[model samples]
Target: MDQVKTSIENGVLTVTVPKVEVKKPDVKPIQITGKPTLSTNFEEVTWAKLKSAICAIFLKQPDSCDLEKLYQAVSDLCIYKMAGNLYQRIEMECEAHISTALQSLVGQSPYLVVFLSLVERCWQDLCDQILMIQGISLYLDRTYVKQTANVRSLWDMGLQLFH
Candidate 1:
């Protein structure tokens, strides 16, 4: 057995201990696995459901939308690193709705009051529909949109599309 030696020199304590052979436990390297395999069709199927729900909501038939399922789909897409695809799809849908809304105003009565009222009504409807969509996709906005640069927040994107 090795003994420890201690000494005090110039008001400083010094301690020396003999060394002993130490065996290190074996550590095996872990095989790093990639993310779970998602079927090539998963994204398309999920986006189809989401797109239908979005269109229904825009048509003022939100009661037909399964909000919980939509939310889960959005979360799943984000978790699977498909947030960019989801974002682009939603943006395209909004653009289509906005274009349709603009086209609806093209041949209305020439009276300024009616035109202004229709524009205001379209704006109001757009804001309401956007709020609903934003609620369903809240997780994606908070997680992916917040972390990714140049990605607009949901509400901002809605407003931009309307503009």
Candidate 2:
């Protein structure tokens, strides 16, 4: 159901990438990839394994990865780490994701559109990969982030990592 249409008029090429169309009162779930569901067995998911998967994904490897599995692994850790009073580890990992993303944006031509696009894309990727795990840290978000008027929400916290 996904498609790309292209038209060439004169010297310019117009490419159209179709986005998901929604119907009234029946919103479809966000489909991040073709293989959308990850097995929720987190017992074997170590930080090293998760880190490797993340590096592969960010490095744009051609291998098809199950992001749902990665997210579930992350959620499992959040339940244990975030509540076990090891917030620093989670913060560090988030920062690393942003840093690697920013590094990838280097060496591109200095176009405003490209700059803004990369920044937004960076944030979007973080949100897409992590926000779905919100329920894992929903209490932390509601208590630690939302309770304070000036603090950013869990979603914003990821965005700020890029900034």
Q: Report the number of clashing residue pairs per model.
A: 0, 1
What is the per-residue lDDT of model 2 for residues 64-145, given as tens digits with 9 covering 90 to 100? 4465655555555555543333234455666787787788888765998988888788767777655643544455565555
lDDT of 1 by residue, 1-163 (tens): 9899999999999999999999999999988798678998999999989999999988877555579999999999999989998999999998999889989988797999999999999999999989999999999999999999999998999999888
Q: Which numbered prediction scores highest in lDDT against the true structure? A: 1
Local distance difference test, per candidate? Answer: 0.91, 0.60
Report the error of model 2 at residue 128, Å.
Answer: 1.4
Please give the distance, in angstroms, between residue 118's alpha carbon in candidate 2 and its true position after superposition: 2.6
Q: What TM-score goes with each of the models?
A: 0.75, 0.44
Model 1 regions lying over 4 Å from their true place? 1-36, 62-65
Q: By summed lDDT, which 10 consecutive residues of candidate 1 come out lowest?
A: 57-66
Top TM-score hit = 1
